[model samples]
Target: MADIKAVLPGDVMDTGAAARDGAVLRLGPGLVQADERTSAAAAGVLHSDGDLWWVAGNRRRYVAAEGEPVVGVVVARHGEGYRVDIGSAHDALLPLLAFEGATKRNKPSLAIGTVVYGRVVVANSFMDPEIECYNSHTGKSEGYGELAGGFMFKCTLGLARRLIGSTAPVLAALGSELPFEIAIGVNGRVWVHAEGPEKTVLAANAIRNSEYLDAKQCRQMVKELLAR
Candidate 1:
């Protein structure tokens, strides 16, 4: 039986058979089939919802998935799009026309090494993933596009998720000490901007260090960092 716990690769979540209770099980990300076993493909905490099972890992790498938002860096310009490194197995495409209100004659210009936040439009194992900077339905930017000045850095996907959580205690604690703006990507990138560079660096370091900390530990960490 699969119980709530931290799991590693090759740790079996279940067998490829129906549960004894007659409930069907579904596999989510970070899980793969091996023979008749469903095992973890990454290291992290295991989570389940109803019959669904998935793993959340904290390695500094990105896994591309459709509809997921990610932070990307422009690597090169292709014919009609830009090649973006989203810390994935494959580089993603951010087309020149993928922005809000973009047109042939009104394309946005981005230099190499530009940081961007976008949603994955296409992510298939057979091809490179594609990203878009606009909401297709509303045709608005909606906070997706070339990210402005900030101290951008990378962290583990698990840490990124924790930082992005609405009630993350680390963020709350840091907010008490510094005024900052942050953007978190599920793909393991973070951008932080504060009134001063020192505060931004402090906030970033605090977040990265708080990955393994509990709520109380996180508050203590913030206090220690601010005192330095």
Candidate 2:
């Protein structure tokens, strides 16, 4: 007979029952599938059904359902929808409305290759977990090409998670008293709008490393460069 499942607050389990499938049975009630296996307790990584839903009393609670965070890479585009590559599952769906700063809805918005990271907002809502890209919230690029003065710079994907607002001065070498606008995008891109290319290159280089610059340092560098 298959054992029922359970969930507890702590990561460790002291008195979990075992199943014939070899996986540990959780502390509460859950009938295993006719032909399935589970661990005694969730000692290793858990492959959730969608997300863990706990039930019953606090001490003897049950993880009746299994689930995980919904993170995915955008792969293809459809009419007002996106096909994302969610590991181990089919590509998830992303709607145009899901994108922030989008004036229009029910049409194409995000481009392919734009990796969106987010947890499954609706795990059981669909057959698979639903993902809401963190990129969507950053007012992601609605425009496909360059802006007025110049195009944005590209960097490592990790930079997207550590977005520095436009107010923060990054690349110090660009110039001080620039008298121009510089916008840093959270999607690992930089937008510079100055009088000429010389100023643009200088600013781009300094700002590229802006993540390490302090306000005072940025000011000093901008001042020194502008005076040049």
TM-score of each: 0.79, 0.35
| Per-model CA lDDT versus the true structure | 0.82, 0.43
Q: Worst ten-residue run, lDDT, model 2?
A: 53-62
lDDT of 1 by residue, 1-228 (tens): 245589998888754344766876666568876676788988888876557677886555677766677888999997899999999988999999999999999999999999998989887678899999988879998888988888888887777765665536889898887788887887889888888888889989988888888889989998988898
lDDT by residue for model 2 over 1-228, one digit each (tens)? 122245433333222233333654432212222224322233222222212211223222112122222334578877766776644334566665564444474433556665454434343325654454434435564332213544346543223223332345443334435544554432244556677887776666556555566778877766666567
Deviation (Å) of 227 in candidate 2: 4.6
RMSD (CA, angstroms), candidate 2: 14.2
Clashes of each: 0, 22
Worst 10-residue lDDT window for candidate 1 reads 14-23
Indicate the residue-level lDDT of 220 in model 1.
94
